[model samples]
Target: MKFHMLHRVYLLAGVSYFATAPDVLADPVSLLATAIQGFLLSSTAIAATATGAIATIAANAIVIGGLAAVSLLGGRRGGAIKPSDAKSTFEAADSSVIEGIGRVRVGGMKAFGNTDGSTRWRLVARLQGPIDAIEAYYVGGREVVVDPDGSVTSPPWPKRSGGSWMKIEDKLGTGSETAWSALVTAFPSLWTSAHRVRGIAQSLVTYYNPGLTSGTYLKLYQAGVPDTEWLARASKIYDPRTGLTAWSDNGILACAHVLRRDPAFGFDGFDWDLIAASANKADVLVATKTGTEKRSRVSGMWAWESERGATMQQLMDSAGVVLRMTDAGKIWFDLIDDVPTSEIDFDPIDIVEYSWKSGPEAVERPNICRLEYYSPERNYDMAEIDLSGIAWARVQDEIDRYGPKYLDIKLPFCPSASQAQRIARRMFALSRADSGVMRTNMVGLAAWGRYYGQITEPDTGDIELVSLAAPEIDDEAGLVDIPFAIWPTLSAWNPAVDEADAPDEVPELGYTSDIPQPNAPTAMVQVVYPDTSREFRIGFSLTGTYDLSEANYRTYTGALPNGWTAMTEGTNFAYVAGDLEGVTVDCRVRIFNGEDGSPFSEILNGIVAIDNTAPTMPVASSGGIDAGTLNVSVHGTSLNMVAIRMRKRIYNDILGWGDWFDVVTYAGRPMQDLNFSDSAASQEVQWLLQCLTSNGTEGPGLVYHYTPPAP
Candidate 1:
């Protein structure tokens, strides 16, 4: 007789269910509903039948000494089972328990017996209504009832080394080593039953504190066992050579041990087979991807240790995968870059309401420009991978404008900088992609069904989905589809356009007195004679004004001094000759504004004193100091109209020449003799004089040196 080979190459090893025959026998029926109902109702009968068939197959294999190859049939195929059917089956089973209880309305109860053949037995039960207390009793021994607030009325258990049973005020407080030891010691039946003791403690703690984590439960459970023994027991369950168990209860203890022992074990390779094997050995289901896409091998080690400890979910995140559990308690893995395989469309007709939001807060840019990892064994640092080339400009621009937004991840497991950089790049890319999140809302379930799946808006050609709500639900329908909240894909978010053609506003026109002439409060105005058709070149200071090319011309208008005239040529204004000494003239200028000339500036009044000639130098008469007094005479052609200034120096035979004395002056009064009282004891003295015209013009100086009487 032909028989199906039970062993599947893809199935993980050490699965005992398929040791004899095929794990799942082919059901010879097409109607799924009937098959499901029959299977559920007569599961025991089916198991017995399969056992007998397996025995027959085993006998035949012994005789033949070789197993024959048979076509493999995929396990049960159909749409997901309806939740109502499963719920009804569960309710029916619960009803059977209720019926067995008969008239005694036991609120809740649990019993435990020693598997190690001890005569001791333990039972914990909650009394109905008025009693309002949970009681724990040993067979043929004393019973203790505890109030909801952990107030115990004389516990039957004795105190342990670290803690006391009588002192436990709450379920959460029972996680201490002494408390756990007290519970096990008080009830000897739990001495050899680790799983039972853990379950009972977890139930109690969860009853008191619903927020207690599975990790916390494992920690509390392991507190009673020695580290060596715990490791040995955990290895037996999570080594893969042994059978994998459910991830809860004792299995959680095994997982915690392995994680706490070697946190970087998962990052050893890029192969999913190894990762899945490790997860399976730990009684965790880390789903594998079935595709031809190239996989990345991580060479570095990733290590983490915290007093609060870490969850398996955080481990999955470190490995760059999202952890999701199915309804059957199986695990699923989704890559960070995995896009939705299907799209859902929600048109305006199907949507009852909608909302959307986008702003600067949602914008994300690359933060990490490089990645570095250290290797202690190598005694030297690994080569640095240059991430500056990847989106360098964008990352730099963000840093330049908003300071450095760097994310430096410490990955000790990374054997090389290249691999660490790859991980960093992946994180950077994901962050950048998530930065511009466009959250939107719509009504109704007429869209794709899956968390993180894509949804297309027919009205605006936008694709969105509720990405924040994962594992629990992926689509708007799961959230009742009323005002479905979703986020737009990074590629679908349109950035604002940059308007480059718009010009900046022009500044107002103004001027200042740039070049001030002597005795002139305004800018210098060059006077020219028109005898040879000469023009004066007057330069003016201007600001808040455009370049010459940008402006048409400068216009000049002023009150001329008889022979002077002003005219606008180009940027410069031409002025005819003007012998206008002591004549004040008012002048103003306006610049062309493309369409029309600007308003004339405020009037600038300046006296026209076109005297460019310097005053004649003063002459100093030669003289020698005779009685601590030196006298000198200075003369000039324009001495009456100019002030005389003089400086004197004294020279001694030993001290050389003394510094020039302070300048002395005579106001426009031409002095025949200039006198200075010499206080210095020097052998020689020198005097220098200069003349300044009334217009403040200074002439060259005349120098005279003479010997002074020795003191």
Candidate 2:
């Protein structure tokens, strides 16, 4: 049997060994070579002899073959057995071709080869139990176990009689029951291995789920036992079928776990207790249960779900928290609106590059005429709020002008709509507020300086009032800007006062200083006639060199035909006369410097005229008539230059008089009598005349009739 195994090994190595006699040599080197050849020949002879000597081991031919093959490969590769080659040979050999089933001899085989008998048994034993155990276990039918050698086996059924049957009949039911008990004894170790395999499978399946991070696959692999309860929980947490909550919760838990585990994310200083307290105040749960906080109570749950590729930072951003690294290299998680205690300034020197855009595109102003907020705690589902009446009227006016814009924001921990609305409105106002960017290159102007307060440009005298948002800066780039709120300084003007004094004058003590002789007062005189009365008055506006109080004024030469007298010695003076119509008067002002004894001042002359009446209408008298023409005499007013207009029409005709024509020579002239010729036609001709005075007054009309002479 050993010989057969050695032959099989030789066949596996693809080589054959045939014993042959070596020729004897006299020389030493040739003798040495001949001896070595003789030794190999002897080894082959022994292998053949041993194969014929052990027929009982023939049934274990395959195992023998595997060992022989290991021996041959070891001999070729410097006398060391390759475990991989042995395993492959054992796995590939046909068990059916071998005659019997029993462990093959592996010890004391110096003639055949040096084989590791212990290692060979261990590999066989390691594979043997699972095969035996699986065969022993049973379900509806007896379970079958397939061996690595391609042999299948099943455990025997319980006997109906004898001791085994009696034992089975008394307590255990059948052989399958006994086998199952044995299998259960070894199930833990087996289940652990199976669980690890399942974890790998699950990770592969969920690799494409959104919000997956670098450590997600590791987490999935570490997930404990697979059971219905665990699966249900996993489905609730990660199943997209459950809607945004599941995916979001998964992402949140994933990020939370990552944050908790990261050494740089200073969870040591995080106030979990405070977060718990604040979360509990909501009366609804907000904080999610985490692996690190298993024992702590969670009052709420929050999910952050987005597209499949969303990053951990993006999820945290959606939660309205900022994740930043501190100067000490620790991570800080803060509310989006939290203001830093220190101020930050980013000057032009600190910025590398920057751009700004403002208009309808940067900020959308919506009308928002009405505001309503969801209120689950209130009696009503929603509560109405006033937007226009708020203090942010300027913001509202922008909204009103632009049109209504709607935004629904979720405030996770807010207890009531009132609170939520206040926060929402504040956030909205901040969002719509003015923002700008100023790039600078100053390194000391860190991001902290942006919130520090105002930054002033000393050179330009331009000041940025308040920082609206955080500054983005880092050591490498050394560039940043006070992003959001910026108000430029207003320009102003200053005035200077002149420094000077006035001189003083004194008057004589007892007697008033001799009144200085008054200069002639310039006078403007206008004659006005009152419609209510026939009286006329001269209106005068006067400017004098001396104070009017020190001067006495009087109307001088050429006052009206009547004895018109001046009423007062003031800058404005008037003289009244009842019968001054059609008269012109030369008026002058005489100013007395002081009392009656003072000499009169030089006269200031002005002219005033009154002509309140219009001229009388002209009278026309007919003269001798000639063929087709007639001569007539016309008389007009004698007070002033007079003009005449004449129109002709047939006597007793219903048609109105023709257009008037001016007596050109008599127009605006001082003539009272004028002769004119009019056309004499087949019927009688009538003449109508009206007169206008030089003062532009018009009088009533007069008519004259004449008959043309026969041709």
Candidate 3:
């Protein structure tokens, strides 16, 4: 069973129940409180109390595998010992680095024989500092404090007779009893009894923190000991490995020399595969080429530039590494991958042109189109249409006649009740045509829209009746209301297929319904050029002609034309000018199923330039030269206008080109709030001003610079 299932079973089964005898009944209040505590404890895995009492268990109680307790040890305490009092007055030790204003002292390492039968190592660090210093020890032992009379107070430990020392396990060395013997295990042939003596002497420094141990260990391994007496005491340590011992000293140096400096430079962060594939080159040109200036700079890397304006070719003749800053602001580091046997060079402009030409290839393909069909009554009414059938017979016929990619079709008028069936029939015909060579994806079905709020038919049922009614839905019970519908919810959805052999995973279909749901009253749509807002309208009169001015309630106050009625009013559609005012007006229309009041078709797939706001120019209100500084005027509306870019330019030879500044940018906020003022005196602002004011020094001559503020 699953873990959760087992837990549930245990909870239900472990709960005990008891019945009270007639003579003695349990206390109701106490029992109820106990029950609540029991439930909480069992469900939450926490210890709980009923009347504010605690519970105790055996020493071996299994409280669960993952519980831990906080240590009673608190924060660091105290003051340091002065360096002047290091000798007689304080307990003195050699090489112990101590600190403190008061005379609190701590002893360094002390060697001792391993009297206990636990391990072969023995070393103890006595605590001579204040009482709080005991908390810093890895393994705490007996603590002793000396009074003014030199009397001692010894603190007892739970276990005594044995002191703690970090044990070093040995498996591959001779004379293993001594520390020096173990240190030389890396090179067995060089070991001797004298070397074991040195290991003992060096062990004191080795058994400390990493920084102290690393520095001392490398010195001992490389230079042996500094004193001749110490060297003479352990001269047997000398071996052929002594000179090459640097490989084991530092990680970075070891890896760089032993690995990368080899014949095959094994650097990690480079593209090794590409380097290996290039026939005659040790390094491949992996940088992405962008912009002419960067390419020119990279090509002239080996050349020198003089303060007198001498060009690269005029100063140098050999190749070298060059760094070029690309127009797109990428730093390209060019290295000497291979040297040419003969003299080789190219003009900067020529190199720039070559770099530009070595980019990716562009391809051209035929255009493709997509279409959708919707019905009116049933939520889902379309049936599978034979793709080879008459779906786009008329459209195809027209296409074949005029030999054009675009075509349209008009269907015979049908009543709202049978609209679903008619649409399904047309969908099947189009599907049938799709299966053939003529791709029918471009065609779309537009369910005829209704005027007013109700759809009608003539008495004979042979002629369709159209009426103009109120735009308000409540007033359209007897009038015409446009309705839309589609079929096979999942049929229109296409799943992306995996290029490899992996099976495609099915995704859950998010909320979508055929039932009528309320939609926003004022919805927007967009359309492309030639289809202006004023020229677009949806209506039905058994003829293709319809006037939009006669359809809107406000514009058609006199009366709706022929079979139309008012449904609702307001700015449903506006011209390009409306879009310029930070508004989006779509020219697409929606068809609704009047009965359910739900959308039954696509989102019209309108094609309007969503970015309609024109680019704006920046107006400087005040920021150009106040108190020897530039206090210019600047004020702008629609500053984020997509089409425009704002920039400032200045010239001042006193400061270099490195000092220029721009406005601050934040989401939907004024740039002035982040303005730079001369009085501010910030290092960054000052440097930027200096750079901007300077001309012909690392900066182009007085050209306007545009920089978008950081997000």
Candidate 4:
């Protein structure tokens, strides 16, 4: 709750580009196919212009926006083009049935078939609802798509659901083809096919049922598929359980064919090669060759030694990578070195745990992990650690040690809480465990600058707003590099330029410094954008130090010359500016006890000095001792002018401050020039000879004079 003062001055005119945002958008040229067509006309132009990127990939991904007009309009058209066929029904004739509740059967069903005697039949049925409020419901079916090539062809048979569901079917010619078919239908909406549907069903079971693994689900698919059809030969499933999406290709034509269709899942499908060239694109396909050659390679061992007191290896060994651990032991891929190979693939995702350690010297180290391939994508993740399920003791300890360090910068304009959270969080690689951990409801941090303005912390009150001033032509006369000192609250910040004819009372973004305040605890801080009338938010948690409303008494004032004009003033603050040489300002501030209205006793009172006096002319210092020396130095009459003061800033790492020290106030000895043996031979002595003849009135100001120090 402590308040601190920060006075930053920015030179108005300088660089061609003003503010440099922390995030660098992804290669714009890389946005092709679905991404381009999806985000093109929406916020694409604005994002492109503002970020100066050609393609819309980075802009579309990071920028908060409404649905693209083209998409919305197309959706409307699609609604109009609503399939000529609406509802669909599936009928199969099977003999064995459990009539009372949900039934199970094995033979003679059109969609169901018995390939092997020991194989079991599974039935799955679903109900597809309306276009808008429609929801898909699984009805139930045992066998489907047997003799799929002969029996099922073209548009394929309608799934046991409403017509709203699109029907797609792919026949597997071999075991590999079955796998490939399953992969194609993994995500129903994204891809549709009988094999894919079967694969998705198995994936669903594996994810939801603890005892059921992907193999168990696959067994059900194998048992249900009719013997009349050919099995697939190649197919790789993209695991959705993990954050990363990696694909595998068996060197078989199926996998390669799918990839060759669109290398990066439609990324290269677009005609734009510039984007493909600019983007980070990679494809890895491993296969067994006819003959094996002996080779020696260096195995890489990346050891993350935790200065925070624990090693990643120990944590992983204990926790394991699976979401849930059971008595059967943790489920994770064991590192195997069966083949005489040199290099083992290492990924950051493979890391299991990290421990926090701190020292008396204020140093903190946490043993975390980095992916060998994508080192930039490090995660604080202890592979199997579900931070949500962590013990309270550990969580609290983390909260105490690190304060808000884990939280990313939350901008106000982001679309949703999730987007805001993601933006706020540093990428897993950039995450530092020692930094304070903050709880967030979602992933990306929202950048809603229009709502929130700059944040301020005054000396005697809770953190408040010091509305940033509308950029004006300073005497220096230059376009203000705004971010040099003041940062906007949001990324899509569109500030309105004030007009010369506009009334001062009107709150124009660029010209008026009108900062808004929060109305309620839940109400976000909203500010009218300078450029456009649209309002934006400035983000910050209001519950922290300002939990209560308490007034403080402070007798503080800045020492400024009288000639300067006071642009604005507040109950506890005021701003005045003028040409430094033309003003003679004196300002002082003192803190006092509010209850008694008396000066509060402290180590030292707050005082800022200002000198508007011009450099005075030097005088002839004839100490009458005529033999001692004629020290020609400026001897000022006023105490303030006696010591010419200037402010010097030094960076203080320990204190997290740029220490602004008063350079002139030091009680050190002054530099003296004497018309003696040494001074007589120097330029200083030559000045003195001229000064003695001119008598004080026509020469430089002698600020001060003193005797030589004891050598």
Q: List clash counts for every candidate, in order.
A: 13, 31, 63, 90
lDDT of 4 by residue, 1-711 (tens): 211111111101111111221111111211110011111112212232443322222322222222222233332111100010111122433211100000101111123212123322222211100001100111112112212122221012222232211122332111122223332334344333423222111111011111235553443233433222111111222322332222221111111122222112232222223222211111121111222211110000111110100111111111111011111211111111111122111122321221222211212322221111100011111111112321210224544665322322212111112211222222221233221111111110221111113222222322221122221112233212111112212222111110011111221112122222222211111121112222111111122222112111112123311111111212222222222222222222122122111111111222223323332433333432122233322232221122322233333336543544433321101122333221212111111221111111212323222233333
Q: List model 2 lDDT by residue over 1-711, tens digit each.
A: 002121111112212221332222122222221121221110111233444324213311213333234344432211111111211212222111110001111100000001132110101111100000111111111121222222221111112231110011001111111211221233444222212111000100001111235343233223421111000011112121232322112222323332332122234433344333322332223322111111111111111111111223333433333343333322333333323333555454544554544423424543242343322222112334444433432345555566556554433222233333333443454445455566666453444312335555434645555544544444465544446554322222111111011112222111243544344544323232212233333333334443332222223223312222332232244333344444454333333233221222444444433342565777654464566565767776433323666666665356645555444334532234677677746767766666654344567777666665545
Candidate 3 lDDT over 1-711, as tens digits, reads 101000000111111123421111122311221111111011112243512211111101212221111011221111111211221112123222121111111222332222222223222222111111111111111112222222121111101233211221211111233333433443355433433221111122122111325543452223331110000000111012233221111111211221121121224322323222221121222222111111111110000001101111111111122222122212222222221121111122211111011111111110111221111121111112122223322235444554433222211111111221223333333332211010011110011111111111212222221111111111222221222111111222111210011112211121133543222223232222222321222221112221221111112112211111122211233222223222222222222232111221122222223323332334444455333343433432322221111223343346743534543321111122223333322121231221110011111111223222333
Whole-model lDDT for model 2 versus the true structure? 0.31
| Residue 399 miss distance in model 2 (angstroms) | 3.6
Model 2: how far is 313 from its true place, Å?
7.9
Between candidates 1 and 4, name the one with more favorable lDDT.
Answer: 1
Q: lDDT per model, in order?
A: 0.32, 0.31, 0.21, 0.20
Best by TM-score: 1
Model 2: per-residue Cα lDDT at residue 147: 23
Tell me the lDDT of model 1 at 356: 50
Model 2: CA > 4 A from native: 1-321, 335-342, 346-363, 366-394, 412-415, 448-453, 457-711
RMSD of 3: 41.5
Residue 1 alpha-carbon offset, candidate 3, angstroms? 65
Where model 4 places Cα greater than 4 Å from the true spot, the runs are 1-711
